[model samples]
Target chain A: MAPQDDNVDAVEEAMVAEVEKKPIATIVIIIAMQTEALPLVNKFQLIEDHDSVFPKGVPWVRYHGTYKDLFINIIWPGKDAVLGVDSVGTVSASLVTYASIQALQPDLIINAGTAGGFKAKGANIGDVVMVSDVAFHDRRIPIPVFDQYGIGARRTFSTPKLVKELDLKVGKLSTGDSLDMSPQDEAAINANDATVKDMEGAAVAYVADLLSVPAIFIKAVTDIVDGDKPTAEEFLQNLVAVTAALDQAVTKAVDFISGKCLSEL
Target chain B: MAPQDDNVDAVEEAMVAEVEKKPIATIVIIIAMQTEALPLVNKFQLIEDHDSVFPKGVPWVRYHGTYKDLFINIIWPGKDAVLGVDSVGTVSASLVTYASIQALQPDLIINAGTAGGFKAKGANIGDVVMVSDVAFHDRRIPIPVFDQYGIGARRTFSTPKLVKELDLKVGKLSTGDSLDMSPQDEAAINANDATVKDMEGAAVAYVADLLSVPAIFIKAVTDIVDGDKPTAEEFLQNLVAVTAALDQAVTKAVDFISGKCLSEL
Candidate 1:
């Protein structure tokens, strides 16, 4: 072979070797609150890296660690969309998710949290729902233009094999900034056929889609969407139970990624 | 009186004179879009101060000028909450509003924009509505601790006498991140007796309230909330008409402030 051909072969071999040497998989798990993230933190024994700094005045909390050949990061975006007390609504989630994606360049993103389920759709308290698709029930941009804006249905797929192995319920989830739903909203939610609802999922999914990363949502049902009691009352009462379910689902998800998805990769 | 008393009296009079010499009123008008702010910008002949920089990477547009005895500043927080394409949700609004408040220290803030109004509540396209109270319909915490968090029923009063003089409709306005609403949401909104619905109003009001400044919302109806057509189509089609109404409403609000509210102050 010519000298140049020999050189090219050597370069290609080095590139392949370099690729193989990199971490097998990196997963970024973004949780909205610390309570929702505690299970994963404890389970993984993730350490809070005090050396890392967020932008000045940003209130988010973050933790990270390596677990069995996989790198995992958890960020609790400080602002709440529903209360409008601390952070801007979907904007904070989008920006933080985007920044997290940019910073970590993860292979997968998992948004783990608690949600209110629709009883009419067989969603009950403490049930873990694996989100297959997400749409914004509250995003009511008027018709013909809504499709053009491309904000109508933001869809994300989970690892179907993992879903089957875990025996998870795959369903659609709706996201909005409101915490309490009026009777009319309940009717609309029922019509949408969403099994669960939360505030941050669509925004996170939208960011993941933008970055060409696979994203999955694992939400524990904390309350009934159409319960007779106020949402705040229900959420407080069931947070513990829901969080326990969330803990199990997250562990399963991590196991699936490490055992199944990473081996394939 | 002694010589010290006379000297103190002179200083007191000078201090009062200095206070009187400052601008009588400073008004910060925060609009969510450039389109919503254009009329006020043109009417006031606001010049873009290129030298005044926002914190790096904040997706907000700014303009400022003096009109009559009032210093008027306009800010356009780019994009909506649904897409999460730019900036974090209410965080952006809160941060930008907070920064603007710190920089300008305006005596009053007016959130002027367009909204989806409920026709059942006597709303029509291009009609102006003055907001007296605001709430978050989507902030469902579902916990008994919610009231302690106090994320509900944020109330802001317009200059009551000025509101009366302007002949504006005083009613509640609901704010959320979603640009679209479901049928059930529409019914719930109607039930809440909210005259108008829009994004960013509550966050802005929340910030203003935190800063101990009075705020008012002046919204021009761009579309009917429960109209047969989609909201995006309606918003686009009626942009011009709605903007015209917004322009008129803003002008009247400014007049009330300069001619009536400021005089009271």
Candidate 2:
């Protein structure tokens, strides 16, 4: 064989070795809303599990299936049985995340949801941001050290290679239970240096960190929190499009994460 | 036997039967702060658990011991390791409550803590409130049905017997992450018709309801949210005294719960 043929064979062997080494087998994607979860579920061909996958009588829903080399599960805090509204706050998110971790024991956690972005931070509707850090914008316990504790700032697992490979925009995320921002929340969000805000990212980060599992936040902007448009109307108008954008981003991220080591991401 | 002797024997037999009926064997008391927990821990003579009762490296502390006929466990979301501050929000409260339920499978859960009361609601300093209803004051999602969903209101386990026996003050409680109330939170609180506001009661109620565990709220007044004094200064000044009040109330509640069934409470 020619020297060129030998070089080509060596490159092919390295690529095969990388593909064969499966470091991350199982992944749990925790989405707070059914609208945010359905597209991914369809894309992955996940089956809805109703028979005690989660504790019965609870609104938490789980869908599971295999995608490439990854065993993927999507966990959504289902609609409140009485009120018939999506349970979309940090309380539901944290419990669902903790329960998912306990049940699935996933190698990694992905918190995917729609968020409100800041116009000043150059965020537009339909932009998908890979969050680098997360902090609470409304947990204002103003006592000396406890004030810091209330913020509960946490860093998501670093994904430098994934960010570079996918060419994704990166931002810090702030979380609070309120869908609309208050003055105090704005100040706290500013202090966090956040470009996007949501109700569940920081909470999921807290639980994932507590369990020693690596977590990444993927948020698509549904509204501009500081812009001229009313937040409720804006969010409602753009949710479908933003969710579609989020679905695409998550799909690409999962493809990149499949069969890769934590260090590689 | 004489007729008087026969009547005395019948009364004694009834007393023995009541004592033997141990309906509620295990009870879990979830307190948010160390200050709130230490007093109850001493009162119940609970031994601190440092082993795998909770997961390793997590700051949640469990104290377990038997008090009368009830196996009592007090779970405190311990101080944050980095910030050295008590974890006092709904996130921590919900997680610790869920974990305790999963580990101990308690027959009843008591969320004992300090809260801000309303003077207009006939609340005074050191008053311990047995919350009848719980709702969120800060989860302000402004959409139509979601606006109500954001409140996440739920009635706590009915404690008519406990209330009648202990003569505890009953109030509707509202929860938020912030120690200080914002205007939005105030409006939500008013809508819920809340008389007391805390950081964790409604969250615990949500978890307890989800798990089908009976839960009661016992909160001592630490500060008045609508009072003239600043919230942070007031909370710091009264935390110790209020915690003592909480300890007494929880002790009495536990005593009442010891040998009783859920229907009795």
- Clashes per candidate, residues 3 or more apart or on different chains: 35, 0
Residue B157 of model 2 has an lDDT of 85
**Candidate with maximal lDDT:** 2
The superposed Cα distance between candidate 2 and the true structure at residue B215, in angstroms, equals 0.8
Pairs that collide in candidate 2 are: none
> On residues A1-265, what C-alpha lDDT tens digit does candidate 2 reach at each position?
1124888779977874564364889999999988999999999999998575677557898999999999999999999877788889999999999989889888889999999999899899999899999999999887888888889888899999999987888999999988998898999999999999999999999989888788999999999998999999999899998999999999999999987987788
True contacts kept of 1: 0.35
Identify the leading candidate in terms of DockQ.
2
For model 2, residues B20-73, the per-residue Cα lDDT tens digits are 354989989998988889888888899998575777657898999989998999
Q: Which 10-residue span in candidate 1 chain A carries the lowest summed lDDT?
A: A80-89
Model 2, TM vs. native = 0.91
Which digits, one per residue and each the tens of the lDDT, describe model 1 over residues B1-265?
Answer: 1124878779977864564455448888888766767878999999876766454334566788888878888987654344434332344555567667767877778888888888878888988888888866555444444432334566775467767777877778887655777554455466556989877677777767655566788888988877797776787789787898788878877876773343243
